[model samples]
Target chain A: MDILGDLLLGVQTAFSFWNLTYCLLGVFLGTAIGVLPGLGPTATVAMLLPVTFGLSPETAIIMLAGIFYGAQYGGSTTAILVNLPGESSSVVTAIDGYQMARQGQAGKALATAAIGSFIAGSIATVLIAFFAPLLSSVALAFGPHEYFALMVLGLAASVVLASGSLLHAVGMILFGLILGLIGTDVQTGAMRFTFGSFELADGISFVVVAMGVFGLGEILSNLENESDRTTVLTKVTGLMPTRADLRAMLAPVGRGTALGSVLGILPGGGAMLSSFASYALEKKVSKNPQQFGKGALAGVAGPEAANNAGAQTSFIPMLTLGIPSNPVMALMIGALIMQGIQPGPSVVQDQPVLFWGLIVSMWIGNLMLLVLNLPLIGIWVKMISIPYGYLFPCIVAFCLIGVFSLANSTFDIWLMGLFGVAGYILRKLDCEPAPLLLGFVLGPMLEEHLRRAMLVSRGDVTSFVTSPISAVLLLVAAALIASVLAPAIRSKREEAFQDED
Target chain B: MQGHRTKDFWAGAIYLVLGLATVILARDLTLGSAARMGPGYFPTVLGGLLAIIGLVSLLRGLLRPGELVERIHMKPMILVIGATLFFAIALDFLGLAVALPAAMFITATASKRFRLAPVPLLGLVAFTIFCVLVFVRGLDVPLPMFGTLFGG
Candidate 1:
């Protein structure tokens, strides 16, 4: 009953002129960035963070959240039209999406992706609307010890779940923790790792690191692979899926939503994991599993659905508990703080309209994405004809502009440049940047909680295990880490890490 | 494949050195005791972890058996790195007013397929102004801009 009233209030707020306008703008820009390769929603949101400084908190979040989902949807378009994926999550979509395009079913593949995303996004929003308050209350039970444990678990999971060697992941995480330690000591008024520079007093900007890894690093990588720019000459036809296609897709869509909604709540690349997991699951369950990689519609639909759903629902932990499930969500938490809103149980009570409005606008934004993407497919497909030479320079230009706009600091731009070089080197070395990013974003939060918990416990280390919630979270993290390291679990992990030939 | 292990080993060694440097740097900072858990606590722990991980990476590189895939193009990678370094140095002195548009134009020129056009140059200039006005002037952000005309 309370959920219904809150949802109603949410709808009322979402329907307002200002909220609606930003929602539209967010989806539009989200789709635009999604269509363009290299820029993901995180960088786009980071770029626009300053622009939204003047708006109300609810309005800003609504638009930013919309951009996130919209980018997920838009990302698939490029994956289908070209083999390029805007992010790792869309990599699976590219597998069969581009294949379907090769078979002259680009329209159907795109339509399925859009519709599946809409259904999945809407369902995820509803789940969040109903489930968030309950989740918020549960989070309210957490003391500092629990938060510290949870953060530790988050960092551990991020390292364990990251693609590549666990050793490298752990190294990256430690590096991130070090980077997070650059600013003045909140506890002792001491500055560490500043190297006597004034900029070091505040630590490295999240925008700088984010832009370096996602924006500049991607551009550098893209520039390297300039030869893979050939577009298929296949014609797109059939805007809607056939009846048989729909029947076959329905079950996969449901499975995807179910998989995504759960995985999205976990820290790490939960959405990306779920999307790939859904595709793999669909193939395993299908009677015709052999048809898995050969341009199957279910392949495109299931993962697309899962990706969007996970992207939307990941906000649950971030909003209700101030626990970010991913780097992007962590950025959103930062944005929330910048807006002077403390995210937690009190948020629901203090700013019901903001919370509900953001939730309701998600559904509206999903609808808007569908309507906007369908027509824009033709436009975006045409955009693919723009030469990489012409296109890439523009992307690089925007990246520089965005990085500079973040704090209007030349130092940050230099910081971004440094990271970009570092990221490129890492990429060359086959070390993934995602784990490093996860580490950088979560490092400061984890430190704060760890210190707070220790302080509250009067420097007793046992306090983390004394609390039930913290104990369980820590145990789960331990189990996950143990599973990765144990000889018995090593074989299964090797299989898990296999490229699925 | 055999030689790449040597590369990885060297890389790990360098990271260890960097981590050690950070530790040395952090030692100068005054971190309070257990009750406060100052900034130095985080970095010192991180530095220790990094050094350990670096050693682990070095060991793994030495032990790995499989043939390494050679996907890295050294020339382009160097070029990209060089360009980024150039941007960092150029951004402040050139004042973004002249620097950004020129850098973008140069990047376009570097791509080989796209020649420099007046349109992109003009667009970047316009964007630079918009960014300065909105982010710096309007928002009061301390960006490094030579604003004799805009009253910096």
Candidate 2:
């Protein structure tokens, strides 16, 4: 069957009464969580993992996916209103978005983002519906060697895309791969880094590490400078974009959707890099590049669209292959595992309803977001008025509850606190949390693959880079390392990293 | 001005100590063979990375090119960390019945913006009861409801 037919079949499953309701529930909860500063989709998905134990995996996943993408929409709300990004993707949004808000065009900026996101999300869903089957075939063709190479590529690209020193990023990726190796080895069943502690046997929970690293890390960083900065209190005007505003947004939104859909499939830094890349592309392609920072509607629309589109399509690599592109997808993979569903190539054939239903629900959820977010802008803005003190404690409570509920062990709670402190220290030292979280999430997987590859090749060290795919990936990694060492490229790349150019 | 320099120096010294400790502890574990590898393989690598990163940080501090001291947040950090510790210690002893409510209260009050109001306690009580009914009895997850309700 053609991709469209399969997508229509997926829509048939998704449009059912139960699935539609679940979609709505997912989007509502997702937006609510996303609006809260510092709580990204990873934490939200982890918190909700237990609640979905009763539901069918499809229903649970559709709802969870809703939260993931809806966050892309709702996260911008806080970034624009309060000048504090809810997630890293929204950091660039804050640059132009808060500027617009400060100029009393907060409503216009948000409205364009919402509409642009909807358009981009719709188009991206269509692209996913059409492209996923083909991509799944490609993933299916990959051998163990190819899979290992792909992961290395992901790790390297993530390093390239990270915001700081290239050397630091490489170090962080290696750190993550190492941390991932801490549990019982899959092949020999010999414990790697446990040091005889039973708690260390199963390995560190990515949830604990991620929550501590990004969630608590941000809170601690903010508290460090809490007294120095205050949240902006911007008055919103009309929420409607003018016709001229709409005209200016049209091309960028289209281009952003196209770019983001393709970029979103990259494993490590797809959604985030796509957003920054789309913004840069818009600037370079724009007739008037000078209009960028001064509330150009495309500045708001393009990245917003790209962010949502990338967010939707990012599910491809995760669903088709067992590998996750980012921490949120890793969390999603964990959720799928908890539900007894392995998110790999067989998932499509083994669970067609789940596969199609999820694809169909993305469109429904996007539409639902437009419905919920547009009218509720006032309510969300009111939520931005919440004091950081009250808000942060609630977050801490959720983290405690979520972590404890997973294993029903107080040990995990203590581990979470330990991670919280560690995260705070990392933040103080200017280390980016995303790489750490990514490292922690990918650590175990990388180790499993490494040992498995070694065992298969009878301890052959060259096996990892001998394959054509692996060689290409390693070449790319080497080039990235070389460019980092070059002073000229290093300076240009730093400017790109800062997005100041 | 002297206090600022002293602060960076101490911070660098602390990192150096931590890195040295990691290396020393790492030496105790054999990272296994080059071919097969073992459990300690990754941590040893990470420890080395941490040591290198720490050295770079220490060197950066040594140069002292610019002023870098910022006021440390003692209160919220202590409260957040302390409250989490309190919850962990209390959970097994007091059980979820008393421990959960107390933890929730501590978590709620940890925020500097909150005031000691009766309303929050009431909310905590209601929330605990809801969790017990849903997660413990309703879902039948066999949570640690009470330590010795029947017998130890």
Candidate 3:
């Protein structure tokens, strides 16, 4: 009953002329670039964040969120049309989607991904719309201690689930937290790491750091193997799936949506992991497993559903608790912060229109993506065929201009350059920048809560454990860390990443 | 010092140095009691944890065997980063009209596909103008088409 009221509110805002145009633009642009082999939703969002600064926060977010899943839709297109996945989450889809393409089922594969994304996205949007208010109510009860503990759990979970060695992830988090603590201290006004530079007074912008690390850094690393790249577009036909094809995919889509919705809500898990998990699940549960890598329709349907569903529900923790489940959410959190809106439970109460409108816009965006992707599949295939040589320069130009536009400062550009190099080196060392971004975004909040909790309890460190909710959160964090050490889970985590490679 | 995993060894060493530097830099700030933390408290603790993690990673690098670190591609790294730096330095002095093309041109050289042909150069110039028109004329992003160098 209450959801109906919220849905009406969402409809009133989402149907506005400007919102619809921008949302469509976002999905269209997102899909175009998403078809680019190396650029994913994360990079696309980061690249385009500067464009959103000039608009209203609601409209800006609507567009950015459109880009998020729009990229997913486009990525699966590339997965089917070309064997190369435009994004990591679509890797599993490409395995079977490409095989189906070789079998002259490119149209069916693309249609399956499109239709499945719509189903999962529609359902997932409803879930976010309904669940956010409830989670906000629960979060409303959280104190500084509970907040502190939950953040600890979020950070720990990100590191544990992070690819590569657990030690490296922890070290990266520490490094990020330290980097975040740079600039004048808010409470004490003491400069921690500004080194007396006047520009450093405000602290490093997360936009610059993120754009450099994920955007330019990625470009540099990609250029390392630029000479040895190839693309062969399979001719796509028959955009509609037959009745038998649709029937075969029905169960996998349902199962994937369910699995994805759950995993997407977990800290440090999002579309990438969910798609991988759902693919593995489909293989395990299928009657004919051998047909999987050779173009089983379920293999295409399940992961596409899972990926879209995961992308949608991953917004839950971000919208409710302000903790990013992944880099894209971190960018969203950064966008929200840039708009001067603190990202937490209060958003639901203070900005109900924004809260509900974004949820409703996702469903609208998914519908638009489905319509846009099918006819535009040919264009997207052409995009992936463009050599990386030309694309890299354009992306670099965007980065140079994007960072400069943020504060109209050359210093941020220089900082981005430094971080670009740092990012490349970090990647070379087998370290991931995703968890570091998480830590950097969460660092200030973590320290603030830690201090507030301590101040409230008068320095008794045990107070963290004394509070029941806080204690349980800490226990969960401990268990997550312990699980990382269990050797078995560690191997399985490696197994998932290796499968994609 | 000379075991396998040259990459991890260097990564750990860098982390260890960074951790030490952070701790040393923050030594002057007061690390107050737990109940009332000073500005330095979180950084100091994080820095210490970093050092410990670095130590573990370093030991692992020395003891365990893994694949050798991939060789760094200095040419692309330098060209890309250098081109970016050039853009930053030139944007104010040279303006987007000249600086953007220059940056894009330098970046094109990062790949082996770069050349001095008129078409490629013309394309670069056209793209730079398009960017200037969009960001400057259309969006009014405050970048100058012609800067102090041209007496604008």
Which candidate ranks first by TM-score, i.e. highest? 3
Q: Name the better of 1 and 3 by TM-score.
A: 3
i-RMS for every candidate (Å) is: 3.3, 3.7, 1.0
Candidate 2 error regions (>4 Å): A95-106, A225-244, A499-501, B1-35, B38-69, B95-97, B108-110, B118-134, B137-141, B145-152
TM-score of each model's chain B: 0.57, 0.71, 0.91
- lDDT per residue for candidate 3 within A256-283, as digits (tens), equals 9998898888767788888999999999
Top candidate on lDDT is 3
Model 2: DockQ against the native? Answer: 0.37
Backbone clashes in model 2, listed as residue pairs: A176-A439, A180-A443, A180-A444, A192-B39
**Better candidate number, 1 or 2, judged by lDDT:** 1
**Range of the 10 consecutive residues with the lowest summed lDDT in candidate 3 chain A:** A226-235
Clashing pairs in 1: none
**Which candidate, 2 or 3, would have the higher TM-score against the true structure?**
3
Instruction: Compute the lDDT of residue A249 as modeled in candidate 3.
Output: 89
Order by lDDT, highest first: 3, 1, 2
Native contacts retained, all candidates in order: 0.56, 0.37, 0.79
Task: Score residue A61 of candidate 3 by CA lDDT.
Answer: 93
**Number of backbone collisions per candidate, in order?**
0, 4, 0
